[model samples]
Every structure is written in structure tokens, then in C-alpha cells.
Target chain A: MIGLYIVTGVALVISFAFDRKKTWAGLKKGWMKFYKTLPSYLFLLMLISFILLLSEDFIIENLGQENIFLGLLFSLGIGSVTMMPGFIAYPLSRILLARGVPYMIIAAFVTSLMLVGVVTYPLEKSYMGKKATILRNIMSFLVAAGISLIAGLFYGELV
Target chain B: MKKSTRNYLLFSAFLIFSFISWLVQYDFGLAIWDNFLVFARDMVLILPPAFILIGLFDVWAKNETIEKHFGKTNNPMRFIYSILLASTTVGGTFVAFPVANALYHKGAKYSSIFTYVTAASLFMIPMTIMEASILGLKFTSIRLLASIPFIVIGAIVLEKYFEKTAYTLPRVDQK
Candidate 1:
């Protein structure tokens, strides 16, 4: 990310000397596109929060006092299907973790949170190559699930 | 009816699905204390407008224009700008996809678009905070760091492999 910042900055500086008009045009296009999306994003967040509210029962029941592996599996499944924002899930996760859910599942679930979810899938299909998107998602879910299991076991031993 | 109403009906269906899930398991029914849980769940979701906007952006943008900026070239400027753009754009990895598609149609290179999606989806601060809150800071740090290689390798490998697939898919301009 740092590398990108420096490189982009240099580009901007160079652009000013050679072609300010082109640079301004790109920035304006990007900014207009970005600002226009804000309201919609807020609405999306609200909708996600609502979806999580419906699944409160699932979280409270399945998320408590389980082996780490099961938790990981559950999280992965939910992550693949659900569209709730990570912010709402974070608090729910905290609640579950304190209740004795295995760290493995929690880890996997957290990983799944950002990487995989059905809600955003249509959009993904639109922007990315369909095959690539599906394959990447499958790989991510599997990796997330496995990483959680290993991390959970290690944490169990250490703590 | 209206889009909102349509979405509401769809949501009701999903709610019913959850209820069926509870019936099958029975263990997941609403506990007495946290009755408000269901309401709270509804607050965080992807809205119809957002979805529409994503689609519109995909449909409206020119392919060649986006490609010129983000295409698989090694210009340091394009690479840096693309990375920063990916990092700050907020949404699920999937939401970012439509943008990538829009960019692709506008002629963004396959490699840079892939990289942008990879970064946008995985490297967001929101994700980091969520992990830290749930498991602990150390765990969060480890997972975040670990994902870096996956993003890089995954984007590069898939970008090349998926190039033809994009051309095959329905373009917004065609419609």
C-alpha cells in the first residue's frame, strides 16, 4: 500500500509538469464516481445490519461453547451465504468468543467475513471473471477454514 | 410494486428460511433475553440502490477508457493509483467486482483490475478491526499479514487465467 502511495504521488507530480488536464480529468472522474456512491453504501450497510438481526438466533445458539473446528465450519458456511457487514458481525463474534466458541472457528469465521459471502456475489460476478471469482471464493473459504483450525489448536495449547 | 417492496418481500422470504432452519435444529430458536436480536440483524445489509448503482456503473462505463488506465502495463503511476483506489473503496469483495467489471469494460487491464479487487476485498481496515475485536490483536495481525501473499499470487494467477472469461460474459454496453 505504501509503495502504491509513493508511486501514485510521483505520477501526480509528473503529470502536473506534462499534462495537468489529463490528471485532473482522471481525478474528477474518480471523485465523482466515489461521492455518488456514498448514500447507496450507507443504505447497504443498514440492510446488512438488518440481515444480521434476523440471524441472531443462529449466532446465539450455534456460536456458543463449541469446538473450534465446528465453529470454523459454521462461520465458513454462514460467510459463504450471508451478506451482513463485518462490523455487525464483530460484536456478535465478541459475544460468542466470550461464551467459549473455539478460536479456530472464530478465526475462520472472521477470515470468511471479508473474503466470502453470497450477498456480494452478484456484484462480484459482474466485475470479475465468473470462473475466477468462483474459484477464488472456494479457495478462500477452504483456506480460511483450515487456517482457523490450525490457529485455534495452537492458541488452545498456548493459552 | 416498487423496488423497496420487492426487496422487502425477498427479505421476508429469507426470514422464513431462517425460521425453517430454526425448526430443523430447534436449538437455535430465539432465547428469551435477546429478543431484539432479530431486529438488530436487519440493520446491516446490502441495499437495492447500492446494487443498482453497481450495475449501472458496470453498464455505463466505457471499456477502453478504463482499460487504458488499469490495463496490464507496468507503468508505476497506474499501478500505484490502482492499488490506492482498491484499498480505499469500501464494500464486500463481491461489491468491488462490479466496479472491476466496469473498469474492465472501460479497458482496465486484467492484471491491475484483479489486483484492485484483491486489495479492496482483503486489505480493508474494517476487516482488520473485525478480526481484532473477535479473536485478539495478535490473531488479527497474523491473519492480515498472511493474506498478503495469497492476494498477490491469486490476482496474478487468476488475472491471466480469467482474461478470456471476461470477454465471454455479458457486457453492460451490449444491453
Candidate 2:
């Protein structure tokens, strides 16, 4: 996060130096964009919080080491709704792996955790419109499921 | 409906839901509240820089530059470059949207935009390292390798489908 700040700061400085008017216009655009999306994003976060409050325990308990079907469904639900950061998600999945959770389930959770965003669907809709956003998300879900199946089958006994 | 009105309706729904959850259980309400605040903090921390970068790119990157780099009619290098650029980003897919939109505005091709979003969402250097360390190198490698062809094919398919679809997708205007 600090790195992001530093880079943006430097870029801002360079932009200002290059063209003051353009730099100001850019900053204004950035602010407007942020403001315009703030409400939808807040709503999304609230929705996610509600889902997390309901499902946090359910996920840890029900995502067993067997039953690919149930695990996939559970993981998909968990991953699609929650937008946990990579740092927390990877470690959490690692702990699940250590606890003998099915690799397939964990893989699906992790893959969809990054790729598919049910929570952020509205945000995506604004950019890509309704159809493309839905299509991309469906494709992403399939990709995540495909990766999980492959990982689970190949490393069935190994892990 | 106006976007603002829709947003407010969603926010009201959230508030009502939280109130109902609170009535059911105090702790559940508290947990939801805390999580909401945490996410709000995350947004404050992450989004400004992302938007700033997007704005800078919008202001600075010429249409010709975007086109020259990502506008190839049928070149493998365009896909590779797009994927490479996307994979280097160290943030979530939400952050990528503005940049991708900016690129689209600047005349980038749909296939390139598709590849960029796919790579950004699925793979990144830091994410890859984290995955390798947690999931082991073999699992990471397999998933990574498996994703490449799927992403490419999916992008191509979407491009073709978009051409025929009733809802016109966004396109770069010729300058």
C-alpha cells in the first residue's frame, strides 16, 4: 500500500511538472470517478459483511476434506461472495490444506477468491455493462472450477 | 432509475438488513459493523492511488500509444504484452477496471482488454509467489499453465460473440 502511495505521488509530481493544467484535470477526474463509485462500493462492502457474518463459521466447518461436489459448491459460495486479500486468503487456505481439507475445495476457493467477484459484480457492471460482466463472471467461475478439478485429480493422493 | 437513487436504495436495504440482523443477535450486528468498517478502511487506503493512476494514464497515454501497443489486428505479441502488463499489477481486479477502461477509451482492442483483465484478475507476480509458497510450486505451476489457454480462448470467444450480440459493446472511436 505504501508502495502504491509512493508511486502515485511520484507520478503526480511528474504529471504536474509536465503539464499543470492536465495534471489538475487528471486529479479532478480521479476524484469524480471515486465519488461516483463510492455508494455502490459501500453497498457492496456492506453486503459482503452480511454474508461473511453468516458464513464465516459455516465455511470453516462444512468445507470438509472429501465430497468434491459439496466442497465445490461451498467453496464457490465462499469465494464468490468474500473479497479477502491475497495475504489472508493464501495463508488461510494453507492452514486448511494442513488440516487435510481437499485440495480441490481449497483450489476452487483460492481461484475464485481472485477471479470471480459476486460482491463486486455491480462495479464490474458499470464498466463492462450487464451482459459482458455476467459472461466474464460465469467464465471465471468455470475457470476456477476447471483448475480445481485438475488440481484435485492430479494431486489426489500426492497432497 | 437514476444511479444515485439506485445506490441509495441499495444502501437503505443494507441498513435495514443490518438492523434486522441486530434484532436477531447483537454480536452478529457488531461483527457485520466491524467488518464493514475494515473494508471501508481498505477502500480508503487502496482506491485513491488506483484512481490517480487511472487518471494519469488517461491524461498521458495517447490513443496512438495504446493502439500501437495493444491494437494489433491478429498478432500473438499483443496478447502476450497485454497479459504481461496485467500480470505485473499488484492489486485487485477492481483497480484494473479503471485502467482497462482507460485503455479501452484510448483505442485498445477488446481482445487485449480481455486478456488484460483476465491476467490481472487471475495472476500477478506477488500473487504467484504467495501461491507457490502456500500451495507448493507444482500446484501453482499447473494452475498457471492451465489458465493461459483458457484465458486466451475465452477472450477470443467473447470478442466474436460481442460482434454479433444485440447489446453493443464499447469500442474505441477512430481518430
Candidate 3:
């Protein structure tokens, strides 16, 4: 996070040095972009918090007992809806692994958790349009599913 | 409904839900509020600088430069460049989407833009290191390797589909 600040500060300094008017323009543009998206972003975050609070325990409880197909499906479903930082997600996955959740299911959960974003749909659509957002997310879901299966086979969990 | 109105409605609905949860279970409501605040703080720390850098890029980056590397060219190298760039990105998808928007406006091909967004989520260096340390290097390596081909292929297919449908990005309003 500090790295991000330093880099942005350095870039802003250089940009100001090169051209004052353009630097101001850039700052204004950035502010506008940020402001415009602020509402939806807040809404998305609130929704995620609600979902995570309600479902986290339920998901953990249900995830452990399912067969491979059902496990993968459940993981993908939960992963798509909830977003978390790597620190939270990775440790959680580690705990699940210790709990004897299959490697492939964990793989599915981790991949889809990062790649698929149902909660991010509004933000994505604003940038990429509806069709592209839908297509990209659907494709990501499929890719994540494939990755989990491959991981399963590689670990010799699946014959 | 108007966008602003819709957003306001959604926001109100969320607040109401929180209120109801509070009424039902005080702790559950408090937990939800804390979680929201935590995420909001993180976003507040990360997003401003990221957006400022993106704005600078928008103001300074030459379209010719983006086009030469990632434009409509048939070069497979663009995908590699996209992945490389994605790996270095800091602020996750929230930041990635704005950067991708700037790139698109500057003439990057759809395939390259898609690759950047998808790879951005998967390949952040810090995230990968954490995953490796927790999950084992083999698991991390396998997931990364497995992801690359799929990301590339999915990007290409989505690009082709968009092209076939004549899909265009929603117009970003400029004030």
C-alpha cells in the first residue's frame, strides 16, 4: 500500500514538473471518475459484507461434506458472490484444507473467488458494457472450473 | 429508473436491511457494519492514488504507444505484455477496470484489455506469494500455469464474440 502511494506521488510530481495545466486536468479527471463510481462501489461493498456475514459460516459448514461435483459447485457459487483480500482468503483456504476439503474444491473456490465477481457487476458494466461484462464473467467461471478439475487431476485426487 | 435514483434506492434498501438485522440481532447488524467499514477503509486507502495514476496515464500516455503494443495487431506478444502488466497491478479489479477503460479509449484491442482484466485478478505478485506460502508452491504453480492458457483462450473467445456482435464499450461521460 505504501508502495502504491510512493509511486503515485512520484508520478504526480513528475507530471506536475512537466506541465502544470495537464497535471490539474489529470487530477480533476481522476476525481471525477472516482466520484462517479463511489455510490455503486459503496453499495457493492455493503452487499458483500451482508452476504459474507450471513453466509460465511453456512458455507464453511456445507462445503466439507459434499462430493466432488457438488463441492466444486458450492465453492464456485460462494466464491462468485463474496470477495475478500488474499490474506483472508488464503488463510481460510488453508483452514479448509486442514478440514479435509478436497484440493480440487479448494482450487475451485480460490480461483473463482478471485476471478469471478457477481457483486462487481455494476462497476464492470459501467466500464465494459453489459454484454462484455456478462461474457467475461461467465468465461471466467468456466475457466475457474477447469482449473480446479486440472488441479484435482494433477494432485491425483481424481482418476 | 434514473441511475442516481436507482443507486439511492439500493443504498436505502441496504440501510433498511441493516436496520432490520439490528432489530433482529444486534450483534449481527454490528458485524455487518464493521465489515463494511473495514472494506471501505481499505478502498479509501487504495483507490485515490490508483485513480490519480490512471488519470495521469489518460492525460499523458500516447495513443500511438498503446496502439503499437496492444492495438488491433495480430501479435501474440500483446497477450504476454498484458499478462506482465497485470501481474504488477496493485489495487485489484476496482483499479483494474478504470485502467482498462483508459487503455480501451487509447486504442488497445478488446482481447488485450480482457486479458489484462482477467490476469490482473489472478497474477498480482503479493497475492501469489501469499498463496504459495500458505498453499504450497506446487499448488500455486499448478493454478498459475492452469490459469494462463484458460485466461488467454477465454479472452480471445470473448473478443471474437464481441466483435461478431459489434459490441462497443458504454460511453464514458466526459465533463
TM-score winner: 3
Worst 10 residues of 3 chain B by lDDT: B166-175
- On a 0 to 100 scale, what is the lDDT of residue B104 in model 2? 75
* TM-score for the A-chain in each candidate structure: 0.69, 0.87, 0.95
Q: By descending TM-score, how would the candidates be arranged? A: 3, 2, 1
- A best-first ranking of the candidates according to their lDDT comes to 3, 2, 1
What TM-score would each prediction reach against the true structure?
0.60, 0.86, 0.94
Q: lDDT of each structure?
A: 0.57, 0.78, 0.88
Q: What's the best-to-worst order under DockQ? A: 3, 2, 1
Each model's DockQ score: 0.14, 0.48, 0.72
As for candidate 2, its interface RMSD to one decimal place is 3.9
Q: Give the alpha carbon lDDT tens digit for every residue of B1-175 in model 2.
A: 9876788898887688768878887776778887787777878888888888877887788888788888744566878988888886656677777677778777777778788888898888878888899879987897888888878877878777876764544431111
Query: With candidate 1 superimposed using the best TM-score fit, by how many Å does residue B3's alpha carbon deviate from the native?
Result: 11
In model 3, the number of clashes is: 0
> Which candidate do you rate higher for TM-score, 1 or 2?
2
Best by DockQ: 3
Worst lDDT run of 10 residues, candidate 2 chain A, spans A150-159
lDDT digits (tens) for residues B1-175 of candidate 1: 7544554566566466557756776433333112324323332233233343443444344665565567645454555566677766654463466567567656676667666766676566656666676658887776656665565565567666766554443343221
TM-score of candidate 2 relative to the true fold? 0.86
lDDT of 1 by residue, A42-135 (tens): 3343355455556766866875533544555677887666555565667777887788776666666667766775555544554354676687
Residue range with the least summed lDDT across 10 consecutive positions in model 1 chain A: A37-46
